[model samples]
Target chain A: MATTMITTLDRSSRAAARGLSDISIRNLFIIPTILFLIVFNIFPLIYSLGYSFTDFRASTSAAANFVGLQNYRDLLSDPYVWSNFAITAKYVIISVAGQLLVGFGVAMLLNRDIPLKGLLTTLLLLPMMLSMAVVGLFWKLLYDPSFGIINYALGLGTFEWLSNPKMALYAVALTDIWMWSPFVMLLSLAGLSAVPKHLYEAAAIDRAGPFYTFFRITLPLVAPILMIAVIFRTMEAFKTFDLAYILTSQPTAELISIRLYKMAFQEWQTGRSCALAYIVLIMVLAITNIYVKYLNKVKER
Target chain B: MRKTMTSLLAGIGLVLACGTSVYAQEKELTIFWAEWDPANYLQELGNEYEKETGVKITVETTPWPDFQTKAFTEFNAHGDAYDMVVGDSQWLGAGSTGGHYVDLTDFFNKHKVGEVMAPATVKYYAEYPGGSSKYWAIPLEGDAVGWSYRKDWFEDPKEKEAFKAKYGYDLDVPKDWKALRDIAEFFHRPDQKKYGIAIYTDNSYDAMAMGFENALFSFGGELGDYKTYKVDGFINSDKAIAALDAYKELYKFTPPGWAKSFFVEDNQAITENLAAMSMNYFAFFPSLINEASNPNAKNTGFFANPPGPNGDQFAALGGQGISIVSYSQKQEEATKFLEWFIKDETQKKWAALGGYTCSAAVLKSPEFQNATPYNKAFYETMFKVKDFWAVPEYAELLQQLNQRIYPYMIGGEGTAKETLDALAADWNATFKKYGRGQ
Candidate 1:
């Protein structure tokens, strides 16, 4: 009896040790990822937040002083800052709207049984795969007033596409649409293909007209996915800098991100730029929140 | 087996330790410069320096737009990454005042550097604030904006006769802005796929500032009172307005998108035979001469910037200086490198390797005069050079001009007077912020 009791005690002690070891292993697995995020992302975000309330220049070694909310007050009262925001909003609207229309139209056409459909879809997606810097440079050459193939093909005589202030913003928006519409189209194609064929059959048996059937059946089902694409693109469009900066130097087309870049690096206003970045982040978050609410409402319906 | 393995490991460790000791004995230095043709020459020179001395030297390059930010960031962080830097002339003020660069005044006096370099370069590029006694850098590249035109077109007797008959003046090198305008108008032929001139008004880089400052200064406008930093009456003066108006009027004869053209596009227009004339840095003359199949090079003629309406002539200074970083741990080695680089023999080699040297002896030599078609003009223009603010707040002041003045000149945003007035107001605010206002 004594031997058996001793053996049982030893077995219980081994099980306890295994339990403790399992807990330690679980902690080890998660610690490094959490540490990385804390070091790189969280720390910088907090550091920048603290800097937003100070007068700091990244190009000098002087210590930064807390200036209360002066940076925010100055930025909010500045007309130039507001003008940049206005330009960004307009760009986002135009670019996102164009992408939606072209993307949906292309997705609808491709939904049919066309020959070489897979290859055509892949080729159409090529622009989105390119780096933004490369795309900006390619489009700049295409928009060159003297030797660009674009004006040549259109038979327009000496049209300054990028130099003209009235046309520059539109030119940049057109380039963005050309690059990102493919992304929207790919997402939309997946949504369109997922639609049940039985629903279309039911509509046909009811002898419904094409327009009516699309309005009642197809439109509502795709609305959720379309909303998701719009939200993603709206955020991306608001942060555009490369295309607008490289293709044109017109101040009227200056987006907020470009302004932030100039303030941070060119002017060395690190504190002010951090505050500006936070303001932009908050604005984007508020917009995305509204979008998410609409998406939730669509799902409920 | 275990004993044999231990012996092998110990031998390997001994070899590594000896190798590391040898490496530690050799001093290493790094130099940072913008990515351009000059950088390649600097790298070649670095390799030679390494061979001569037992020290290893590495050349780091970044593109123009990113160079300032990258260099300043390293300085601000007190990083020991760069022993020396080829900094823009405008950076002298900030670099010296912020203690980013070592004060080179003692070094200059010790080395008698003034005897070797041009006086104008020393005054404008090396001095901290215009004519300050404190020196922070050594002028390395002496450059200015020089004008070049298609020699073939000017030499064509038929075209010359047509130009003379139409404009009632002989078709030759323009002597003033008015004559230049007339020539531009004569050569503008959109239907025949030709353009008159290539001048930049783009705010994308330094092109707008460098291209337009000379005209503004020649018209009797001042950026500000150097001592007091007062700009209200200077930048927005009547002469300044007239100069801007004249600059805008030339848009009619330029390529369709001339407002967007920078150095690359301007060079392309000249090389591709799309433009009849171009204005760019003298440093690019060597490249223009070597362009393959370029007819303009065979017949190219160079001139200083055309005189203004008031008969004042000036060209924008376009070059930089070399300075040792204040935080460099290899200061002794870097100073040795600079001493070697400024020698007469080294400068001769530098010029031969396609580098623009500010050495007085090299520039005054007959070899430099006949170096290229534009070499003589380059020498003359360097003497007539004027520069913009070289203050710590230069970037802020320049931002205002880029935002306000360029849009008016190129984008038709507002009247020139209004643009200048707004720019002056912005300048006043920046000065006030820095406690430098009148």
Candidate 2:
């Protein structure tokens, strides 16, 4: 009966394909959108790749000329660029790790049948809903040495959280974690809610504890969703800029995005900045690829 | 029913036609500017100008980081984003290319903006590459860097006697780096209840470079060559090293975590009366003279940056200059506004407004000087202020220097001479990169 149903569906799909092939104008409607993408997105990427081989400056069009691999060579020896990358790495790792850990713990706490769970979850997600600039500015004021509530509460003598080079990155990372942890928590909560009650019931009947069931069934079942969440959040964390840029007093807390922005806009080194952006893109793509591979493995299990 | 619908359609068409005509009649001018005191003041003056001329001026305030980038992008894209721009003096070189800025030589000559303004102000803004013609921007504000100290502390009889006994010099306002150092050291007592001075030592490019620029220039060393950037011995010469070393010595008298102080901290230090002397722009001192924030308002005093061995004091001028954008749709209206804006009358209004000290003309105005007792000193100090790295790539070059020099000065990593020498060597490449011949 199943084989007969599959054959019928295959035949219908074949007939549908034939009918679709005859419709010309219907297919041509997408041509304009494809053209737009080619012009705006693909063309710029190709042009930037070409310009990366030249002395391309955004400010002076006349100054740009072909100089193969010179910018890349310069970047290799550039201490400032390397230092920026180091700072960016520090910002991304610390922020992503902190967000995931805190988010998972909070999600676990919120998933339990507790009083005011709905209201508590809504309140927890407030930071995630705020615009990045508002979040940045708010945190900037909060981190203010004299009048800030953070220093007032810490009573740790009002540190220059965003001004001091030693603490600027951490301060920026702290704000990002605060703003984005809720996002991870919401995703995890969705995964947790979707877990079947039968698994827990069966485990309880077998004399399994809550911790044992969580490890053996709940964890394995939610692994795929949690991995996807982590991959998405990590990618977002890598591109962070507004919080670091607005909250920090200087570029000491600058991320890859901030540095790329400064290079393109501030220094007018459009080609170099584009090249750096592409490098970040490649890095993120590789990370996503590895994550997807790991996720597929989990799904297969 | 058909007749009623037809009449309603005709009425709607008539209203649309009338709206278009009315919009056409109201000339709208958009101006983009970085956040500056005069820029904000001009937004208010724009209404007054519009009321007089019947031309509406729409003011858009762009943050400092995005101002140049956005303006240049819009200009290159051929977008009519602004009628005029509040530009920096150093950016004039980039703005003048391809007529990015309107050539105001003839306009200024006709309006006598150069003749009417002070000499220093004219030299800074009115004179472009060739002193003869095609000047790019009008000097909207003039900023001069200087040292401000607490007269209450310096003038106290007991403290004065103690300082004289310790340093063998009268406790008066410092005249040069030597005296300033002596005073900073005297005030620096970590075990005591008070600290002496506040120096901004952040490793970021601008703070470090600008700070170094003010001190190096005061010690008689140039940042780079006239037209291009070049790092020569002058950047790390004996004089420059001496300045950096002196900065380190001065840091000894500063509070703990002195390396982290920027303008905000410096402002806090002076405002809260935690520090005695602070390096800052002259505009910052007006608050110290005001009675509301300061009970000892009369006790605040201003001095020119301490002189070098040559007895000449200098400062880094950072005032924002105003220029008409090349891609402005309403050039005529913008020029008319600019012409009126730079007039002695308008300039006097700007300086008297109190947030900004208009470069030379308004500050030098007797009326402006008489507006407040503190205005006179600030205006007098503007005469001695000079700008650092007026080259196109000034921002990048400054960053390069600061990345190397700041740590050394703050005692973070290396010797002052070693760091200065390293900066000097790296600066050569920077100068060459910017087409400045060594």
Candidate 3:
């Protein structure tokens, strides 16, 4: 009786209210968001797109002149820029592969009924929650050649991790993996939980081996979410800057993002940095297209 | 009618100037500087300034690693966040050309800054184009590359005999680069875990470049002509190659895994008893001199950059000049602060408070020279300082040098001649891109 009275009163109130119609109210909510995006995001995108065609120095108040693809041409032909791209690719592959293996392996262990499961999972996830810069600093101390715990613990005896040009990139990728693996683990865990118990019971009754059951049932079921996690991680790993920057200064660890940062901010080559950014963006989009196709295949299965 | 119009315009101009001066008397003023001991001392001076004047003065600082980035970000945005910046000498080119700093040519002459400060300091730190009347900054912190050594080991009779027997020299402070190398080799005993000198090898920013500049200047090599910005043949000259070879030779005797060591690591090598000698800035020598901060303080001795083969000595200029930001609204008040700051009495107090003052009056005083073990060396270094290009494109030049020089210097990526050739080409291309090269 009370609900009916409230519904009756709300209908009467709406009829009496003339401040805004439903369409107007909807627009009121949506228009500000559209305006905000246009002002903050779209405007910068358009502005930078224009700048990418010019010779602009942000540090100076001089007028920019249009160079008409000169920045792009120069970057495309630059050997050091190519080297940076190659370094970035190596870092992504190493970091993403490591993250997937470690994350899925841990998730497999946690999928089973375990003691203090929540606490164990929380502790494992701690590294992912910490600031990347902070983690890099701690790792630097750990990797120090003299009196570092890693050298002492493993008897590597003063192995240079960050300073060694041959090992610096891999060392940085390893730190990236250590920090991000738990993200993949969490996604994998969710997928594992969602796998129906009846399907496992069905496989057990059929006398399917553990490997067979996992391959036929678990693997196919979790593939979509696994692909999603991979897509997210690969994109982020491609643009990794903080870990690589803070952990090492070796040329081997100079990823493209770091180059972009140096160009845009340090070198103050605003126009060229914008052009190079567009190049990275195009590459990211191409990779995303390939990932999306794979995701579609997983969905079809 | 013409006189009436001129008088009317003059009256308006005078009123606008008065209006700006009135606006400049703001309640507070802020300075941007790197978070170092000098900045702290500057803050103490700021406190004194606050007491003298009604306006509050705040010294905002960032760590050395990100100081340039922070300053440039603010400058790029044309922000009025800082009234003054105690910025690196190299930044004058960018700061002046970009209009980040107010041109102080007239003010400099009016205040007679060049007449009172060290001539080299005025050349490297204040004047953007060496020997020019144009000025954008005041030589504030006068610094140069200096060294500290293990004095206890040097004084050991057995070590002295062994050094004299092996290298035909006494185990004392080296007077030249050749003797320095000899001393380094004498102490480079790997099995005993004691290494040679520690120097800048960190690839980031200007560490390695600054380290190499010591050798470069000593051997009488130049990167290029600063005026013309021409770098093709000069950087690849025989003398430059030899200087680079000398630096790499010195690197061979350093402690293992020092491919990325900088001042902090150099200091650690001395305090941790791992190195016999170390090169660092005079700004950082106080830590090694403080017996509480450094365990090896009592056994440490300081020296300036030694002479080269021809008895020519020059150290990389590693100091900052204070400049007023063009965007700042408190220019009048900032000018007042700087005017008071450069006074003889003020600079004396600055030195007393551990702020490195470039004032000729203070540095020449016997009392100031004897105040610290490194003071005399610092005084000597001030006269023989040289700086890199202070062009607006210096970041590009410095970064390129760092990227090319590091792998070769630390890792032996290529021959010195080849490395220098590659750098010369890189620099030539860079200069052309900036439209400075012929």
TM-score of predicted chain B versus true chain B for each candidate: 0.92, 0.86, 0.93
Question: Candidate 1: lDDT of B202?
Answer: 70
RMSD of 1: 5.4
Ranking by DockQ: 1, 3, 2
The two-chain DockQ for each candidate, comma-separated, is 0.60, 0.27, 0.58
Task: Encode model 1's per-residue lDDT on A21-77: one tens digit a residue.
Answer: 544555676899899999999999999999999989887666799998999999999
**Candidate 3, B361: how far from true, in Å?**
2.2
Query: For residues A1-301, what per-residue lDDT tens digits would candidate 3 score against the true structure?
Result: 7545333223356533755455566567799999999999999998999999999999888899999999999999999999999999998899999999999889999999999999999999999999988999999988888777888999998788888889999889888889999999999999999999999999999999999999999999999999998999999999988888888888878999999999988888999999999999999999989999999999997
Residue B365 Cα positional deviation in candidate 1, in Å, after optimal superposition: 2.8
Query: Which ten-residue region of model 3 chain B has the weakest summed lDDT?
Result: B19-28
Model 3 share of native interface contacts: 0.66
RMSD of each: 5.4, 5.6, 7.4
* Candidate 1 local Cα displacement, residue B29, angstroms: 2.4
lDDT tens readout by residue for model 2, B118-233? 66666666456634466787777676676778888998999999998998989988868898889988887655536788876764435556566667787887765555444566
Off by over 4 Å in 1: A1-26, B1-25, B293-295
Q: What is the TM-score of chain A alone in each candidate?
A: 0.91, 0.86, 0.92
Per-residue accuracy of model 2 over A1-301 as CA lDDT, tens digit each: 7545332224356545555442344346678888999999999989888888877766753667788787788876777778777888787789888988899889988888999999999999999999999998888788876567898898956476765667878988999899999988998899898899898889989999888998998788888888988898878888887777777644566677877776777767777777777778888899889999999999999
Q: Is candidate 1 or candidate 3 better by DockQ?
A: 1
